[model samples]
Target: MLKKIRWMAVVLLTGLVMYPLPLMADHQGAGQNSTLVLEPTVVTAGRIKEKKSDITTNVTIYTREDLEASSIQDLSDLMLKEGFMVREYPNSTISVAIRGFSTDTHGNDLSSSVLILVNGRRAGTGNLAKISMDNVERVEIIRGPASVQYGASALGGVINVITRKGKGPFTASLEGTLGSWDYKKGTVSMSGAVSQFDFDVTGSKSSQGDYDTGSGSEYRNTGFDSKERFSFNGGFTFLPQNRVGISYSDYSGDHIGSPDYLSANDPDDYVNHGIKSYDVYYDGQTRDDFLFWNIRYFKGKDEYETHDGAMTPSRTYWRDTDSQGAQAQITAKWAVAQITAGWDWVDYEVSNSNTVAGKENTYENPAGFFMVKTKLLEDKLVLTGGGRYDEYEVTSDTGKVKEDDNWSFSCGAVYKITGELSVRANYAQAFKMPTADQLFMLTDYSAWGMGIWSGNENLKPESSETYEAGIDYTRGSLTGSLTYFHTDFEDRIAYKSIGGGVTQYTNVQGGTLDGVEGSLQLDIGAMFGWDWEIVPYGSFTTFLEYEDDETNEKFQYTPEWSAAYGMRVNHVEYGLNARLNFTHYGRHEITDYEGTGATTLGPDTVADFSVGKELFDMNKFGKIRLKGEINNLFDRDYALVQGYPSPGRTFYLGLNYTY
Candidate 1:
C-alpha cells in the first residue's frame, strides 16, 4: 500500500510542477503593477507590527481567506496541511515539530519547547487539538527562536492566533455540517460596530462516533462524545488614539476516547478536559505619534480527568492547573530608529488527585526585555538587536524550593537589494527551564514491581543557539522565500536507567539540527489579465541533519521531508470557489519499544478538496452558500504514529447563511 501511494504521489507532483511551466513566459509582464498583490504584516517576529518583507526573521501568515477555503477544524489540522511535521494519535492528541524541536503533547504550557499564544499571551496548554478555529481571524508563525521577544518555552518557535474584531455594520452567520463516522457540527457567530464600540462573538458544538481505517476496519474507541467552544472580543475607542478591550474564550471536551495503541486498545478508557481564559487590555499612543504603549492582564485554567475502566477498581485520575499573567510594553519612535521595552509576569499552580501520593506545585516567572531597530542608507538596510532577563522560582507542597536565572540575546539584519527582493541573516539564543515534575518529584513504584522514578534538583536549564539566513521576493502576482537554519543545543534533560529498577532525570550533552524551508505562490489569472482568479501554491521543508550527541540517533517523528501543494479557483461574478490540496510526508526513524533498534514509518500522501457555490441573495436579508469537502481522497492506508492509524476517506456537506 505504501509503495502504491508513493508512485501516485510522484506522478501527481510531477504533473503539478510541469503544468505551470508553459504559461510562465507569456505572463511575465502582463500584470506588473496589479492591485491584487499586497504584503502581509506580522507581530510575532518583533513584538510590533511590521511588514514580512521588512522583518529579519522567517515568518508565515495565513489570512482568513485561507481558513474559509479549507476543512480545517483546529490548529493541528492547519499545521499539518501547511507542510509542518505533526504527530497525531488516534485519540485526537496532537503536537507540532519545528526544525528538530517539538512540543510536549501530553504536558502543560510550561513543559513545552514551542510556545502557543492567543493574541500575544500564553494559551495555557500544549495540545493543539484543543484550540478551536471558530473565531480566528489570522495566524502568525515565527520559524525560529523568539526568546528575546517572548520569554521561556520559546526555544523552538512561536505561534500566535489573532481573533476577529468587529467592524463596519452589524452582521451574523450560521453554519452546519455533517460528515463520515456520524460526525456533526453547528456554529453561530455575530459581529458589529456602533459609534465607538465594536464586538465579535462565536459559539460551536461538535461530536463524532468511531472511525474506520483506510482498509475499511473500524478503529474502536477513536472518537469523542462531544466538544463545545465559545469566544468573544470587544472594545471601545476613546480619545481618538486609545482603546480598551476585553476577551474571553472557553473549550470543553467530554468523554474523549484515549485508546493508547491498537495492540493495547482499551474500549473503556476515556478523558475529560476543559480550558478557560479571560483578558482585559488597553492600548494608546501620544498625539505626536512618538510613543506607543499597551498593557494587558490575563488569567486561565486547564483541567483534565482520566477514567480507566480497564483497571479492577475502575480508577480515576485528575489534574487541575491555574495560570495568570500581566504584560506591559512601550515603544518610542524616532526618525531613523525605534526602541521597544516591556515587562512580563506569570504564575502557574498545578494539583493532582487520586494518586498514591497526592502532589501540588507552583511556578513563577518575571522578566524584562527590550529591542532596538535602526534603518540606514535611505531605509534600505535594517538592523535589530534585543535581550531579555528572566528569574524563575519553583515550589512544591513538600517544602522544596528552587530558584534560577537566565539571559537571552539576539541580533539580525535585513538588506533590500532591489524593490522586490531582500536578504536577511539572524542569530538568536533561547532557553527552557526545568518542569516541576522533572525537578522535585520522587515516586517509589518498586513495591508494585515497577521502576522507581526520581527527579534532579540541580538540573540546569536546557538552551540552544541558532543561525539562519534567507531571501524573500515579492512582485506582481508572484511571491516566494527560501531559508536555511542551524541550531546547537546543550544541557538536554533525559531520564536514564540506573542500577536496579530505578530511573533518574539528568542533564546530558545535546545535539545539532539543520534544515531548509521554502515556499512559492503565483496567481495565474491575475498574471494573464483574466476576469477570474486561479492560484497555484506550494510549501516544503527538508531536513539536512538531525543528530543526538549521546545516543547518536535521529529524533523520532522528525520527517526527512514534507510538502503541501495545490490550486485554487474563484469567480466572483459567478459566485463560485474551489480548492484542491495535497499533503506528503517522507519517511523517518522511530524508537522501537519492543526492541533495542529503531523503526521507520511514512512516505504517505493525502489529498483534500473543497468547493462552495452561492445559492441566492436576499438583498437586505442575507446570502446563502452550499459547501462540500472530501478528505483522504484516495483512502491510502497510513499511520503517523506506529500504533495509531489515520482515518480513511471522509465526506462533509454544509450550508452557510450570512446577514
Candidate 2:
C-alpha cells in the first residue's frame, strides 16, 4: 500500500512539473485557434453547464462528431473502441467496470455499480444492450463516485446519454448499413421546430445472422438477433423561459440466441427482451434569472423470457418489471454562489411467469439531495459540495417486508494555476442498496448438483469512499489529462452459499480499489502543419487490499491495463476522411471462489480502419455520404471473457442521405 501511494505521488508531481513547456510553442497552423479546446460543455459533473477543465472530477465527453468519426454501431462497440474496461460476449449481457467496481457474479442480479442515465434520469435496468445509438447528441463519462448528484447504484461512476432536439427548419435523414455475417441495419429520423413547438423522431431496425470465429470454427448457438426501436420527443413553449416536453422510447429484441455452455450440442437457448419508457417534464426560469425549476415524471417497463430447446420443457422462465418515478428540482443563484435542492421517488414491481399466482414483489425508494457551488478568488477557484439521503422498502406476497435507509455526500475543488493548466481534487462517499430480488426472491433451483437456492431477507447496503486528484493541460493543439483515484469499500454485497445448498446474498467485510487514467491528444494538422491527428490513451486499475481475501478473487476478471491509439487524416478539399485505430488489453487472471489462482484469459490486440467520402451536395437537398469500415483487421482470435471468442475480420458499407 505504501508503494502504491508513492507511485501515485510521483506521477502527479511529474505531470505538474512538465505542464508549461508546451505553452511557449508558436501557434501558426491552419486551425490553431479554432481547435484550441477539445472539450465540450458537460452537465453530468455538477448538474449545470461547465467546461471539462472547470470541473473537479474526471470526465470524458463524446460528441456527435466523435460518434460519426468512428465505426461503432452500438453502445457495446463504442465502449470497446473508447478503451473502457468492459466485458461483452455475443448473445450475452454486457457489463462495464468503473474504477474496478461492478456487481457481477453467479446468482447475482447482473446489476451494475456504475449508474446509467438518459437525459439526467435513471434508465431503470443495467442492461447495456437495450440502448440504441441513433439520435444521440452526446455521451458523458463521469469517472468517480457521484452519489450527491445521483443516488443509489452510483457507488462507482455515471454514464449519461443526451438526446438531440430540434432547433431550426425541418430536416430528415435516412441511413443504411450492410456487413458480414448477414448483418444489416437501417434508420430514418426527422427533426424540426415551428412557431411554438419542436419535435424529433427516429426509428431503426437491425438484424444479424450466425458468424464464425477467427479460428475458422463455427460457434454453435451463436444464433441470430433482430431488434427494432422507435423514439420520439416534442416540446411546446408557452412563454419566455418556460417550456413543457414529452418523450417516448420503445425497443424490442426477438429470438436472441444464447450460447450453450454445458454441452457442444446445437444451442437451443433463446430469449426475447423489451423496454418501453415515457417521460414528461417542465422547464422554466423565473424573472431576474434568480430561480430555475425542473419537474419531471417518468414510467418504464422491462421484460424478458428465456427457453431452451423444444424437447426441454423444464428450462423455461420469464420475468417482467415495471417502474414509475417523479423528480422535482429548483435552483437559486446568489452572489458568487448557486444552490440546488431536489427530491425524487421511484416504485418498482417484479413478476414472474412461472411463479405461483399472487407471488409478485414490489419495492419503493424516496430520495432528496441538496448541493451548492461557490466561486472564490475572482472566479479562479471553485468549490462544490452536496449530500443525498435515500430510504427504501420492499414487500413480497409471502408476507415478507424489509426496509433500510442510507445517506451519501461529496465535496470537490478546482483551481486554475495558468491559462493552459488546472488542478483539481475531490472526495465522495457513495452507496448501493440491495435489489428487490436479493430480498424477496424464493425459488427451488439446482446448479451442478447443488441444493436449493433462495434469497435472504436480511441484507445491508454496499458503501464506498473515493478520493481523487487530477491535472488538465491544453496548449495550442495539445490536450492532455492525468487522474488518480482510490476507493475504500465497506459492507460490500456478495452472493454466498450456506450449508445444505442454501445460497443467499450477504455483505463482505471490506476492500480497497485504486487506478490511474491518462490521455494525450495532439492535432498535428493544427500544430505542426501536418494533415492528420493523433490520440493515445490508457487506464490502469488494481486491487490494493482486501479484508477478506476471497473478495480479491473476483478482481482477477478485471484487466490490469487497457490502451488505445488512433490516427486520422482528412482532406477538406476532396471531402474525404480516413482513420486507423488499435486497441490492446492486458492479460487477466481468473480465480476460484476462495481467491485461488487459475488460468489467464486475455492479452490480446485488435485493429480497425474506416474511410468516408462525400459523394455529392445539393443546395436544398443536403448531401450524400459513403463509408466503408473493416474490423478485426488482423483476424485476431481472442475474448475478454472465457468461452466466448470474437468474430474474425468483417466488412461493412454504409450510406446516408439528408434532405
* Winning candidate number (TM-score): 1
Tens-digit lDDT track for model 2 on 183-246?
8999899999999999999999888877778887777766567889899989998988898999
Query: What are the models' TM-scores?
Result: 0.94, 0.92
Residue 424 alpha-carbon offset, candidate 2, angstroms = 1.0
User: Can you write out model 1's per-residue Cα lDDT over 69-177, one digit (the tens) per residue?
Assistant: 7667899989988878888976667888778777776768888888899999989988898888999999999998999988888888998999998989999999999
The residue pairs found clashing in candidate 1 are none
lDDT of 1: 0.86
Per-candidate Cα RMSD to the true structure, in Å, reads 3.8, 3.3
CA displacement after TM-score superposition, residue 33 of candidate 1 (Å): 9.9
Candidate 1: segments with Cα more than 4 A from true spot = 1-36, 310-315, 354-359, 447-450, 594-598
lDDT of candidates 1 onward, in order? 0.86, 0.76
